[model samples]
Every structure is written in structure tokens, then in C-alpha cells.
Target: MPRARVSLLSLGSVRQGLRDSIRHLQSSSARASSTSPNEVEHSDFATEVEINDLPDGSAASERIAKAIGCSVNDLNAYFDPADPSTLSITAKSLKASPQMRTSLLEWRQNIPPISLRTERAKKAYRRPIGLNAAFEKALKVLTVDKHEKYERILRLTDKVEGIINQFNVKAIDEIPVQKKRSEAYLTAGLIRKLRIDAEINFPEVTSQFEMGKFDMRLPVYQHLVRARWEKNDRLLLIDRMESMHVIPDTLPTLYPQVDVKVRFPGTNTFWIDPGRVMSTGVTASEPKFSIQMFEDSTKLFTIVIVDPDTPDLLTDSYKTTLHYILSDISISGNSPLVDKANANELVSYLPPHPEKNSGYHRYAVWVFEQPNCEPLSTEKLASFDLQNRDSFDIRRFSQLYGLKAVGAHFWRNKYDSRTESVREKYGLPQGLVYSHKRYQHYEDYAWALPDLEVGDENKA
Candidate 1:
């Protein structure tokens, strides 16, 4: 009976039937393998089974036996699946008869290959194909591979992968573990840190976004390698935001900056680097950065601290809001902002308040070298309001007043409840939280003083 019919029988009968089937297969295999030419003369059982299993059955066996000048029984006994000699002998006989050889070759070619019998399995994300020829060759070397040096690469590849494996991003979990968004974030970040030598395309990306292209394993690693090779990539690329569109890394746009050695004065007593984040009130308090002004103390200079990430990050409606500006400030060999007695107060410093819902904000500082002992005129200067200024332009201001940027740097800021007291001190009325849905934006209060008066006094 067929196996389907056997299953419908009683439970005991089903068990017995399965055992019989398994035993039958095993015995047939064993008997087939053990058969020999000498023993087969005494027993026709194995010979009959082997002849039946052949493609042409007994007819092919007899033909092979006649071609080899052997008895049909001997021919079957001598046949071994592992030995190619028996197949060759059969083929020789089949070739002697052209009609049989043609039929055999046609059947052989029509049979499906072993590899094709099984279904093909595919990966969720397909990595971009073809490695850089030199990189591929370098990777295959055993010594380089053992050192883990070849793995780092930063090709401006248009693909990335496997960041959002859909909630299966558990670092530790049972079944149905979803991947965290941070995994993708961290993977992209590591690429910005790794060492690799490759060119970064500054041209506007016209095609698809590269980060979501392939699996994170190799693509993330390549970016890390490339990032490290970049001059200031490690210093500037602090988070996932900068890695996406790295306009901050370009120097020509904002060139020749002053060395801003940042130090958080609070209890944490930590120094600040690019992308380094401090808490809202404690460490994120107004950071004091010291820059040695080679110019004479009597000479006037301008210091403008602005935030480019104003009015929400997505839509940068307000590009560079003049947060704190000190025009005609005294700069000595020592720090200029140190002594309030000599320093002019055009715009006082205000701590960054990212608000509860708002994301990370970049609080940048731009130091401009003012005109060298010339007639300081407020007539030509653009009418700038500290309280009601819209999109402020740094380059335009520099050109108008014969000012050049001397030094520049920025640190990241985020929101926390600890900043509540600080916000009150800054007299924040409206708050940085303009809207929660489309991301909170910085209102006028966040960028400037409520009511600030502009002075045309020329201390120079």
C-alpha cells in the first residue's frame, strides 16, 4: 500500500508499516552494495534487483554483458555505484550501438542538476555587488585579514543595509526580537569613525539615499574606514545627524577658524570636542572656550555665536540665528571675555535650551577679525536686531564691515528638565518647543534677548 493509505490504518498498524518501509529501504541498499561477482553465481536475487534498477533494465545489462564477454549475472554483480568502471563499460557497449547512445545522452542531458532540485533562499537586503578590485585582493590575504585591517573601507558607495530588521534588533531576547533604531544609528556612526582612504562626493546627491541601501555588516564598516581617513571626520562626525549630510566638514564654506578649546565649568569638569553632548543644566551650562587673540587688546573684534539648527532641523527656515554677538569687544593676549570692565556687552551669552520635544541643536561660534583702526561707521552696517532678527548671514556681515572669520567651532545641545532653572535665568518666555509633531522649533526668544538696544559707539 502507498504511504498515504498506511497512515489511515490503526495507530499500531501505522507504526508497524513505517518500520517495515524503513527496513525494506535499508536491506535493499545493503544487499545491493554487498553483492560480488563470485557469490552471485550461487544466488540470482541480488543480480535480479541490480538489473531491474538499471535505466535500460535487463536489456542494457545483457548488452553490457555481451560486450564485456561476461555472463549477465556476473555483469550485474560486478557493477558498483562508487566505481566508474562499470558505467564506462556500459557506455562502451551503448556507443557500439549508435541508436542506444543517442537515447542515453539525451536522457542524461535532460536530467536536472542536483543544485537545481532545491528551492533558492534569498536574503532580505542585497548588498551592492562587485568590490573595489584592489580592496578585494587586499582582503583575501591571510595576514591582512587576521589583523582586521582590510575590513575598514569608506567608498562613497550608494548602498547600506539591515539597519531596520523590524523590531528584531534585540541585543538580548527570545523569539520575535525587533532591532532598535539605534543599531542603525550606531552602525552609520561607526562608519564615520573608521579609517579608510576614499574621496567624499560634495556634489548634491541626486539618486537614492546611501544609508538604507544594503546590510549594515559590510557597508557600515566601509564607511567607518573611510571616515577615519578623512582629516577631521573623527573630530566633527559626532552623531548620526552629521554623517547623513556632512556640510559641517566642508571648510571652504566656513574657513580659517580660531582654535576653540572648550571646557565645561560645572562639576563634571569635562572638556568639549565636536559632537560631544553635555547634560541640559549641569554640564550643558554655558560652556567657556578660551582663544588666544594675537591681536592687540585695544583692537576691536566681533564674536558671534549662532545656531544653524533653528526652527526645527528638517526645515532650516532660520539658517543662522544670531544667538550671542559681541561687537567692539576687547581682545588681548589673554582671553577677551575674561574681564567685564574692558569688554563691551552688545549681546550677553545665553545657555542652549533644546526644549523637551526638540532634538539636538548645534550651538556654533564664529569669531570675526574687525577692521584695523579705521573709521567705525554704523551707517553701512546692516540693521541687525538681537530680538527680532530673521535668517542672519555671516559672510554678508563680514564683507560689509571688512571683517574676516578668525576662529569657529560648535558643540551639540539637547533638552532636559535640569535646564528649567537655566531657561528661567535666560528669561525664556515662548520656549524652544514651538511644535511637537513636525519637531519643535526655536522661537525668537531662544535666539535673542526680548528687547536689545543697538549702540553705534566706536570705541576704536
Candidate 2:
């Protein structure tokens, strides 16, 4: 019968039939490989509707029940918990049900494991080496048990928080009275002690406490501040002074033990950098001084600001002019801000007014510690008048007062557009513009000139 109904097929029809057969074979092989012999095959629809049943007293069942705050049997109808192989199925169920996910999260947060809490607390309060040995030993003796240590940390944290909240509102200027400031420093001292003894991170509280201490100039945190100055600012100041000849020109030498900061209030509120060039207008106003002393004991200090670039036409050399001088100034680690009320203004502030065509002038600020906190006599103070300020000798002044230089700072100024206005305001005389002088030269000898006639003859 097949021979009688034989039909000729085209090449295209044969290729299409072969492709269909290969595709069918691939599909069958894939279906067979998808399900292992041990695995039970279920329909996709059936899997979506199916629920795994949890056995009693299983670990997974207990965990799910605890997390969801429900009995294991109560949740058995909706999802599988005891079957370890149905993890993906349970995850999908949890993802689909927001109520279940939220409940599980709440349960976890409400009842964290005791072991985890202990481990976390220990890690958070771990002590670092290289700290003060005596302080660490004291802490160890006080907090022998974990519970004791944690409780102590909590108490100190509360105390520090209270102190910060109390003083954070008031500024340094607002708390002008010494008695109230002393009380604030006492509280800050307590915070410092806690920080050193606890040896634990206090995050925001520690930083706030430090800011308070710095503003109040408390001695408790002076070491940290001193260390910072010694490591960076001190070295930079020394380098600038030595390189610019401010050292020998102003003073013999400097061995700074304190940190000196200079700022012009109306012009710039920020502290001026060491050896920075300032405009005549910016330096016109009296500068604010902050002398950070490392010593705890209060002592009298003398601040001398001199310009070592003033021109003396008579001698054809530069003379050091006293720009400003304050005597009987009190300063210490616990009180760093310069108090002008208790100070004697030897020479009123004379703003820098460099002459036209003159180079940069160095305004050297020297802080000298007095021998016995003695005030300058009236005679000595009167001697530093405007006339006497023109030729000031710092070496002689320091020798007379028996003063030791503890801190030094300097800034530069040059003639600018505002120099004229400053000169007028200070009633200074007109500045003379200097020009380079030309010198006369002798005529050259006849033999020194080139022989033009001989060269012309050689060319011919």
C-alpha cells in the first residue's frame, strides 16, 4: 500500500521534518533530567497550593513559632517550618505575607539572645593598649565583673550627657563670671576623668564635652591640645620664623612652650596663619590674642608686638618699632583668653602702615612670662610713649623685666591701597616712595674698544 501511495518530497520539506524530530528529542531529554530518581515530581499548580506540615518538637518549628509569636500547630496549615528541604518555599511564603514578616521581625527585636547581647557589649567596650596604665588598672579594679563594667559605663554616660546638655547653651563670653566658669570647668573635669578611666567610645557626648572644655580653657584637656600644637603648629611657626629672619631680627632665639593665636576681629574672625601677609586695613584694628599656656599655675605675661621693618632715613637702616604692648596680663592653661581689663596698655595699638615701595614688614608678637607676676611701674609704662616707640629694643626690654619668651607668632604687612587711609587715621606722616639710585661709571680705555678701521681694511 505504501509503494502505491508513494509521493516525492522536496529538499525543504525533508530538512523541516528533521529539525522537528531533533527538537522533540531535546525536550524529552530535558524533562527526564530535570527530576532526579529520588525527588518527587509535582505539578507547578500543585506546588503553589501545597503546604508543608511541621512535625512536633522540631527545631525549625520552634524557631518559626517563636519568631511569629504563635503556636507551631496554629501555623502548620499555612506554611511548612519543620522541613529543612522546603526553605525556598518558606521564604517565598514569608515574602508574600507582610504580616508574617513584620511579626517575625518584632519577635526577633523584642527577645535578642543573651549570648549575642553579651558578645556585642564586650566588643563595644573593648579596651585598647598604650593607654595610661594606672588608669586602666583602676578601671579593672573598680569593674571586676562584666555587669559592673556595663553599669559603670551607663552611669558615666548619663552623667556626661547631663553635663553637656547643661553647658551647651551658654557661650564662653556669656559665662563671664569666674565663679560660674569654675563650676563649669569642674563638670568638664569630671567628664575628662570618665573618658580616661572608662576607655570606651562616647560618640557625640565625648566630642561635645571636648568642645566645651576647649571653649572654657579647662586644664583637664590641656595635654591633648598641647600635643597637637607641639606636633604641627609649633614646628611650622619655628620654621617660618627662622627662614624669614624673624628670630634674630626680633629676638635672639625662641623656645615656645605655649601656643599663640592672633586674629583681627573686625577684619577677619579666624586666626591668621603664621607669617602670612595681611593688608594694612585688615591689621588696622587691634588684634585679639589667645595664648594657650600649658602650665596650670596662673602667671603674669607681657605681650609685645613690634614691626622690625620700619625705615630710619638718618641711619639708612631699619629700626624695630613697637606696634603694641600689654603688660600684667594673666594667662594659664585654665584661663587662656587674654583679659585686657586687668592689663596695662603700655603703648596704644599702632596699626601696621608700611611705607610705599617698602618691602614686607614683619609684625612679631612675643609672649614673655614675668619673673614674679609683678606689674610694670608707672614710670616704666609712661616711658613707652609714641616718640619712644619709634626705636624699640626688645632685647633691652626683656632684660630689664627679666622676662622669658614662652610663645611667639608673627605676620607680615606691605604697602597697599588702604595704607594711605590707615596712615591718615593714625595721624602718621606721609610715606615717601623710594626709587633705585643710579651710580656713575668711568669711561673705558681706547684699547678696550673694538678696532673698526682694521676690520674694514681686512674685508676690502
Candidate 3:
């Protein structure tokens, strides 16, 4: 019976039938190998034996001779090369045979070598075609494989979710067992101290914002690095209105300078070197002073200061250099203001609110050539006191200085009605002004009031 029919029988009978089929195949293979000569042969050609190994007309030699398609004498021909009676076949001997050569040539032609060559060419060309088709088939197979992989991945994810849910349940049950106790020494006092320290440094931040679980690992660097628990970037703990206190106003668009010294003698003028500083901690509160050109003339002039390095400080008297652009007296008209005034008054007008302009005034002198450059106009000099002023005198002094106009702004002292008696006595207007006297060499004029003692005044 067929194996399928055997399966429909009883279970015990089915097991016996499978055992019998397996035994039958094994016995048939063994009997075939043992009994059959051709089946037992190692190669496709007839088996042969050496002459030296043959026994004289024995059963074994006869059996061996019978196995080959030749007699014993024919086998002897293979061993004897020089014997006139011997016949042998070797590769060279075969090539010399005309029959073999003609047969081989005919056989080669019948094989259709050109067709074989064409077939080979086709096979070579078809390789890429077959490869491409196989590649496309492989791509389709890969796509199916990918789909299967994705399905497997989805199943794996579902399994992972199930595992996670089981773990979460177990974790919930073990939560109380794993609960960590608070440190014994931790108290409200320590918390308060920590909060107080944080509040002192970060007053804008809050206690609620500062509260956090202390990172035990970062305890060493807690005080060095500035940090807080708050997420918001900026905080205004107090209202702007409540924090309102009067701040010193900035005198906009003007650089304030202190004249430490000038070229003239008698008056003490201390010029701080641009390279020098009182300290790295002190920075310029005023805008930087720069020079601009006036196209009207060629005048070489400069504001030189005493090198703070010479005296080790700016308190000592300074030296300055002022080069004259013009030598002809005829070009400059006779005016007393030209000699008496300083550059400050010539550059700007005094503001009505003198308090607003109070500080060290800078006088940035520059040189420019001129057919004319937008006429020397004053934009910030709105409070000029020009009761007895002459335009020629102001212009001459401006030309002499090499700058279009002096740029003046005060930063050293706050302008007060009483403290600055010159403003009160001379009827000086309270804003920026263009005045001749403001540019006079500091040595020729008392650059500052007596209140600014400047111990080196006696030397000047």
C-alpha cells in the first residue's frame, strides 16, 4: 500500500509500515553494490590491471582479463614501448594517426563550432540580461522579504509592549519596597540656608524657582557655577515703577574728554594718554572721540597728551602740541576771542539745562582740505551765547585748530550753577555752543575751576 494509505490505518500499523520502507531501501542499495560488476566499477571506462600484478592463467587473472575488453597479451602492449610486436595508445601516438585526425576534424565540424561560438557570445551577452532580470526578481523577492520583516517587527513591538506592561505591573508592586529614605542630616534649616544663599546671589530668581532635588554628584562645583532651578530665562521680581531711582543721564552723541595738559604754560592741563587707563575695571562711559575733515583748508594740528607712564599716573602735568595750519596773519582777522577762548565753546552751543551738559568736554580736532564741505554747520550747538561774537573770529580759530569745529561734551563734573562760576559770570548758555574761547590752549586759560585742585597746578 502507498504511504498515504498506510497513514489511514491504525497507529501501530503505520509505524511498522514506515520501518519496513526504510529497511527495504537500505538492503536494495547494499545488494546492488555487492553483486553487480559494472555498478562496482570506479570509472566509466573498463577496469584494467598491470601485467606485473597478474598471476599466470589463474582464476583471478582470468577474471581481471575478462573484466577488460582485451586479452592478457593486449594488456602487455601497454607496458612494452620498443617491442615490434606491441601495440600501444598514447596522446602523441593518437595524434599521429590519420584516421583519428580525420575523425577528430570531422567530429569538430559536425559539432558546428561557429554555432558553439555564437552560442558562447549569446551566453556572454545574455549574462547581463539574465543578471538584470535576476536582479529585478531579487528586488521583488527583497520587497516581499521586507514586508515579512516589517510584519515580524510589528509582532516584536507588540511583544515588547506586552513585556513592558508586565514589567510596569511588577514595578508598581515593588515600588514601596524600593522607596529610598531621606538623608538623616537633611533638615529645614539647611534648606533655608541654601535658599538664602541662592537668594543673595540671584535676587531676581525666587525660592520656588530655586527649589530642586540636589544632585549629589555635582556638590563640589555647586557654588562656582551660577545656576538656578527656574526654567524661565528672565525674571523681574520687582516692578519697574518701584525700582525707579534717578540715574545720571547720558549726554547723547558727544564724547567727554578731560584735558590734563596743553601746549601753553601757567595753567595746569593734565592729558591722559589714550593708551593708559586708571584701571582695567574702569571703562569709558562716554562715546569714543574721532576726527573728521573740513575741506576748506590744509592745517596740521594734533592733541598730544602726557604719557601716563612718565609720571606713573595722570595727576602730573602733561605736554601737548598744536601745529598751526596757516602762517599769514592777513588771512586771520584781529579778534580777542581767538586768543582768549578754548575749543569747547567754538564747537558746540551750551544747553539751556546746564546740568544736562555737565562733565568733561572732549575737543576732537581734525584736518581737512576745502573748496568747501557742506558749510561748517552746528547741529548740537543750540545754546550758543553770541551777544558780542564775530563770525570771522570764530571761523579763524576753527581754521587754526584744523578741525571743522570742536566737538565738546563734559563728563568730569556735573554742571551746577554754583560750582561752575564761569558759566554764571560769563552768561554762558546752558547747551552746546560754537564759541571762540572754548578752544584756547589750556595753559593760556584756566581749563577747570579751582575746586579741581590737581596737585601739579603749581608746576604748570
TM-score of each: 0.37, 0.55, 0.16
lDDT of candidate 3 over 121-221, digit per residue (tens): 64443112123234434544433443343333334334433433543532122223232111211221233233234223221222223443333112112
Give the Cα lDDT of each candidate: 0.45, 0.64, 0.28
User: What is candidate 2's local distance difference test score?
Assistant: 0.64
lDDT order, best first, reads 2, 1, 3
As for lDDT, the candidate ahead, 1 or 2, is: 2
Q: Candidate 2 regions off by >4 Å?
A: 1-220, 379-387, 438-460
lDDT of 2 by residue, 1-460 (tens): 0011111112243244335435644564586578554222122111222122224346666656554456777556554554533433346446644445544332222222223437667444422222223443444343343224334434544544444456563332234466655554554455445434432332332455455534323323555567668999999999999999998998989999889999997847999889999989999999999888764556788899999899765345799998888989988667778989978777789899898778999999999887656676667545545458878889988877678898999999999999999999989977877556522321212212244332343322
Clash tally, candidates in order? 22, 0, 42
Model 1 Cα lDDT, one tens digit per residue, 214-330: 221222333433343244633453342245222452223444433444566758665566656767675445556555442223445666776665663323444566667666655
Candidate 3: where are CA atoms >4 Å away? 1-363, 367-413, 416-418, 429-460
Cα lDDT for residue 444, model 2? 19
Prediction RMSDs, each to the true structure? 27.2, 29.3, 37.5
Candidate 1: count of backbone clashes, pairs at least 3 residues apart or interchain: 22
Q: Which stretches in model 1 have alpha-carbon errors above 4 Å? A: 1-252, 268-270, 283-286, 293-299, 312-319, 332-340, 373-376, 380-382, 430-460
Worst 10 residues of 2 by lDDT: 1-10
lDDT at residue 15 of model 2 (Cα atoms): 43
